[model samples]
Target: MQLIGLWALIAATLGPFQNVLGWSISGALVQGYDPISKTISDLAADDSPVKWIQSSFFLAGSVLTLIAAFSAKSLALPGRVALFLAGISGFGYTYFPTALVAPSPNWHVIFATIAFVLFSAWPLLSMRFDKRYHWSLRPLAAISATLVMGATTLWFLLTWLEPGQPIVGLSERVIAVMQVLWLSFVIWSQWLHQKKGAPETAPELAYGAKN
Candidate 1:
């Protein structure tokens, strides 16, 4: 079962990863900067396989995650389902056409933002699943999620590099990195939760102590 879960994770990463979402949804940035003189259109072009990679990876990951979560009750069933839903919604939003123009990604970005929030909460909710889950990691994940969510919400009032700056892509990239860390921590934490009672003689051996 562990091998199956790990394999599913690796397979999902082969093509369907969450990061490509930004490629499709963040397309608006490219469109916003589009100019006849500009030579970067190919970067965000839909013709690229970035969408396929993201959509497929996430699709596969969602299915695998569902299977993994179901097979292992170490995490809360509801939380896992929410995570699965978040992953599913993320794939859907990645390709949805919200922009009539070349690369307007508003719709994808909007829905993806919600998906990110859901994804971030998966770890925190996961602690509710098993008593052996690392309590320390739960608080850390919660704090990270809260910070990311709050910062993203207040992005309008506080610009990353200042409003109307000549180049403004750095902030989004930074935020993306932060999101990646937050998500990685969440998933890794669940993986750890799965490990909490592996050595137990019985499933209830150390559930409360580990909690």
Candidate 2:
């Protein structure tokens, strides 16, 4: 179980790493892709020349995230559920790539919204009050992380909703990076705690067993 948890944590960390790398490389490979104005999803749009690259990355990230969700026993159940749903959302949006000339209210947009909401809110859902857990999973720290992610997500939403918003892509990237970094921090912290001889079970579980 400990080995499985370790691999799960590593997989969770790699999800974000691959996503960031995916967009960076795909964006560069496209002849006229503009990160400032175009969102990451644009790279996987039906008409995108390098759609395969971005789509492949999205699929890989989602699968890795799902692995963590099911196998990272250090995380509270609620957090794991959130990660699972987020992974599902990732697959949804990736599989339903946006069409360059499609109308609004598409599946891609719906799934993307769900993904962002889950990502922004997962920290709060996963937090534990136990001091035995990592500081990042503490109530105060989790609340702060959630607030920061929520605020950035709100900024991205505003840019997305308002037509002709020049910073839409930039704002989206900012929030995405922020959320993933927080997740990575939490997972890595838990892995470190386990390495230092902390109990393998989640804090809540350990507390329950103690009682």
Candidate 3:
């Protein structure tokens, strides 16, 4: 279990790292791609020259996230399910690559919105009041993570909805980074908790056993 947890941690960390790196590389490779003004989806749009590059990264990252979700046995079931759904949504949007001239509320947009909502809400969904759980899974920490991610998601949505929004890309990137960081943090906390030999559940005291 511990080894699997470690694997989960690695997957979680790599998912974010690869995504950010891929975004940077794809942006640089595609001439006229503007990281400050153009959304990452633009790099993977149907007409994008480097669509393959960005799409590949998005697929890989989503796969990694799914792997993490499956291997993270220490996480609450609700959270794990949310992560899995988010991963599925990621895969959905990647494969449905946004069309440069698509109509409003297309498949890509629908999947992306679902992914963002799940990613931002998973922490709160995973919260546990038991002392056996890691601090990151506690109510306070979970609530904080959700609030922060939710705020960023809202910021991105506002920018995305506005016509000719200059900061759409930046806001999207911010929310994406925040979601990844929080996921990685939760996974790492669980890994450390296991490493320290913490009990998964509080063991009941043996009848008449000494303190």
lDDT of each: 0.47, 0.82, 0.84
Error of 1 at 135 (Å): 3.2
lDDT of 3 by residue, 1-211 (tens): 3233767878977977897998999999987878989999999999999999999999987888898779987767898899899999999999888886776668898899999999999999877776656888889999999998988898898888787999999999999988987788788877777676565444633322556
Q: List, residue by residue over 53-167, the lDDT tens digit for candidate 1.
A: 4355445544554554454344456556766676566556555523335345455556555665665566556544233454423456555565665566345214422536422
Task: Please write out the lDDT profile of model 2 over residues 79-171, one tens digit for every residue.
Answer: 889989999999999989988666666889889888898888888888777666777887898889889888888889888868798889899
lDDT value for model 2: 0.82
| TM-score of decoy 2 | 0.88
Q: After superposition, how far is residue 157 of candidate 2 from its true place, in Å?
A: 1.5
What is candidate 3's CA lDDT for residue 210? Answer: 50
Global Cα lDDT for candidate 1: 0.47
How well does candidate 3 match the true structure in TM-score terms?
0.90
Clashes of each: 4, 0, 0
TM-score of each: 0.53, 0.88, 0.90
- Identify the leading candidate in terms of TM-score: 3
Order the candidate numbers by lDDT, best to worst.
3, 2, 1
In terms of lDDT, the best-performing candidate is 3
| CA error at residue 133 for candidate 2, angstroms | 0.6
